[model samples]
Target: MDSANIVVVSGLLIGLVYGSVGLLSGFCLLSSLRGFWAEGDGRLVRSYALAIGVAVAMTQLLAAGGFVDIGKSIYLQSSFSAPVMFFGGLLFGYGMVLSNGCGSRALVLLGRGNLRSFVVVVVLAIFAQMTLKGLIAPSRIAMVGASQTTTTANSVPALLAGAGLSATAARMLAASIISAALIIFAFAHQAFRRSPGQIAAGLVIGLLVAAGWFASGYLGADDFNPVPVTSLTFIAPIADALQYVMLSTGSTLNFGIVTVFGVFAGSLATALLTGRFQLEGFQSPRHMLRSGGGAALMGAGGVMAFGCSIGQGLTGFSTLALASLIAFAGILVGTAAGLRGALRVRPLAAA
Candidate 1:
């Protein structure tokens, strides 16, 4: 296939995998954190950790092998707005708790016949667009623009280089140290090793991260008319997908938007075939209102944060970008606050 076809096909396939995996594994950061906090379960949390580690190792390896350049991804941009990313992550984390799932996870749950997630996804997509280029985009743009901080050492390699290491040596050292730590944490538990589905979720998700890089870096690479290199981020795509639906005449379909659609379609297909499809709705008006509110927060926060859990958690983190780390930390804190009732509002547990 030609480069354009390659990008489209690759995006579709990636979305299919995400949908299938999400359907089967119930993979999601919101659920994982909830399970850990509310149910005293660490399996899903470890699974998520494994995914992050694998993403880091494989993505770094891909860069080291010259198969792709991690620097090309958005995470490593010279413009660094740490506060925006941090607050964005915080919003996404807290929103996920209120919604009871993150964006990608919501898609997966919807496939399993959860109508609640359907509302969440729709809200997320719509608000995400608003955050990206919709009516509220101006405020977001101004916020980020005013807070943006330019930095040469955006990536791990650059940071290491600043510490007096050569470029190649810095890259290798950073990769080894981080990967080793992640691997040890992920594999140290016998419980983790025993759960094949959870482990597979982590592994497959991580591979998909690398796959995104390869797709953009290799398959989508076109000197004549190259697209910006990116991976499986969800926030902006949720918005972009909505825009594409209305403006396909004047706009181009990007990998993120296409992949977002593909995941939903793939999940719907799977749900239908597996006899799991069911029409579901809210139990009360209160629930519907909460779902909508949660989705709005997701969209707005996701835009500020530059991604959702899957977007920043996997794709952004894969690049070993410093901003991704900040975002991740913020997500953790926000999730904790929401789950623990630390926020002014009722916590997830109380709700």
Candidate 2:
């Protein structure tokens, strides 16, 4: 097959694994954090830690091996807007709480016949598009421009090498130390040890992130018209997919769009196979209102940040970009606020 076809097939297949594993393992970062903070359960958090670990190790290895040019990806850009990323991350994190899931989680739940997620997905996609290139574009771009930081190098190893460390030493040391720390933390819990499914989910999802880099960077790459180098980011692609749906006649297929479709299809298929398929909807109009608002925030914020939880948290984090770290902190803070403390938003009493 040609490179385009290869990219399509690879993305679809990887997305299938992502959907299946996500459904099977219930790998929602929001849920994991809630479980840890609210219920004193750390197993799910540990699972997420493992995913970061595996993704970091594999992705860094790919960068080192020249299988992928990490610098070519957006996560490793020379400059980024820290303020936009933080604010966007905060919006996204709180939205995840309000919606009870992230973008990828909503897709998976929608595949299981949840109509609530349909609203979330639609609103998120539309708003994300708005922030990207619609009415909100000007303001968004302005903020990003005003808040931009022109970094010397985006990735940790590159920065380290620029300081003093040798290139190879920096890559190896940075990847090994960070990955090892996360790995150790993930396996530190006995609960995680007993739950093998979570471990599998972490490993598979992390590998999928690396796989995404490979597919988009190498397989989809064209000398004449190259595809963008990216991995498992949801916000922009969700919008792109929505556009593709409306303008299928004029639009071209992309790795991210195909992957989004694959996630839904994969989840749907898995739900059917496992007899977990069920149709669900909002509990009331109030619930519907909450979901809609949440979705809008997620879409807008994700665009401002240039990624969502999975986008920056997993994919961007894998690159160890300083911007990702800032976003990560913003997400955590927002999540904390939403889940508890003074900023905690209670469900509205029925009108």
Candidate 3:
């Protein structure tokens, strides 16, 4: 097949896989964090950690095997604003808490018949578009430009190479160490391995990340016209999907938007078949307001950080970019702030 056809077909196939895996396993970062924090249930949280570990290992292996170039990913640009990415993560983390979920989680919940998620997704999409090439784009660009940092080694591989190691060796060493450690930690809990849903969530999510690389980097590869290589980032794509719905005439569907739609459709079908669909609503007006406000922060923050929890936490980290690390740190801090202590937000009481 020609490159364009390859890109389109690969994209669709990738979306299908993502939708299936996410629906079947209920993969989500916000849920994972909340479950652990509020209830002391760490299964989902560990599942997410397993996915991240697998992504890092597999992606590094791909780079070493010469199957894909990690540097080509957007997270590894020569210049990136540390402050922007950092603060962006903080905003996204905090927003996810208030919204009761992140963008991707909202999609999954919407599939399961949560109308509240519909509002969260809509507001997130609108604000994300505003941040990306929208009214807020100018200010964003200015801030990024002001705080951008130039670096000789944009990614971990490059850093290793600078330390007198070959690229291949660096990749192998990094992948081996990181992946092995994660697998050890995950499997150490025999009870965790016995939980099919959590295990499936980890494995399938990891595979989805790898599949994204195959779709965008390998299949989408074209000498003349190239599509930007990205995986499952939810913030901007939520906005882009909204725009595509309205301006179908001018806008072309991208990998992220297609995947987002596919997840909802797939999850909806699954929920129906499994009798999991239950129409749920907000407890109060305050709940609605907080959720909307959270969605707005997620949209803007995801744009600035260049990814959401899944975007930067999984896909960006998969690239092993220095920027991704900074973004992840920001995410942790923001999540902590929203979950506890001074930054903790009160839950909306039922009206």
Candidate 4:
């Protein structure tokens, strides 16, 4: 197949794997955190830690093997706005709690016949589009503009190399240290070690991260007209999918759109096969209204943050980009605050 076809096919297959894994594992960062803090479980959180370690290590290996250039990705941009990213991450994290999951998770749930997720997917997509290039652009742009900083060394290895280490040495050192730490943390829990399902989920998810880099960077690379170097990010893709549904005549099929569609299709098939497909909806008008507000925050915040949980937290973090670190912390704090009722979004939990 040609490069364009390669990208489309790769995205569909990757999305299918991601969707199936998401459905079976309940693979969600919010659920992980909630499980640890609220439900006295740590298996899912450990699974996340394992996914992070694997993604980082494999992505670095891909770069080392000359199969992909991690630097080409958006996560390693030379200039970024820390405060804007933090604010956006905070909004997304809190929204995950309010809406009960991130955009990707909502898609998975929607596939299971959860009508509540349909509203969330619609709201999140619309607002994401608005912020991306619509009415909300001015304010979002201004906020990000004020905090933007240009860095000579934007990523971890780059920064270390700037500190006088050789490029290869710096990259290896950074990769080894971080990956080892993550693996240790992930497996520190005995319960997680015992849970084969979560462990398998983590491994598959991490490999998918690397596969995404290979697909877009190597498989899709064209000398004449190249596609954008990206991986499994949901925010912008969700918006693009929405636009595609309405204006296919003007739109061109790309990796992101294909992946978005594949995710829903994959999840639907999984739900049916697992006998988990069930029609569900809001408990009341109040619940629906609250979810709508949360979805709005997630959409706009994802745009500002430049990603969602799996976006910045996984794909971007795999690059070891500084912005991803800041955004991840912001997400953690936001989730904690929301879960603790600090933002007054905990009415349902309190009762």
TM-score of each: 0.94, 0.97, 0.95, 0.97
Q: After TM-score superposition, what is the CA distance of residue 146 in candidate 3 from its true location, in Å?
A: 1.5
RMSD of each: 2.2, 1.3, 1.6, 1.4
Residue-wise lDDT of candidate 3 within 1-351, one digit each (tens)? 766567666666666666656767767787787777988877778888899888988787776777776678889899999999999999999998898778887888788899999999999998888899889899999999999989989888788889999878877777777778877777777777888888878987887888888777777788797877777778877887888888899677778778888778877877898898999998888888999999999999999999999999999988889999899889878988898898798866558
Clashes of 2: 0
lDDT of 1 at 275: 88
What does candidate 1's lDDT look like per residue over 254-321, in tens digits?
78887887788778888888887888778777777777787888888988888888888888887878
Q: In candidate 3, how many Å is residue 182 off?
A: 2.0
TM-score of 3: 0.95
2 versus 3: better lDDT goes to? 2
lDDT of 2 by residue, 263-308 (tens): 9999999999999999998788989988988899899998887788
Model 3 error, position 194 (Å)? 1.9
Q: Best lDDT goes to which candidate?
A: 4
Better of 2 and 4 by lDDT: 4
Query: Global lDDT for candidate 1?
Result: 0.82
- Residues 163-190 of candidate 4: C-alpha lDDT, one tens digit per residue: 9998888788888899889989989999
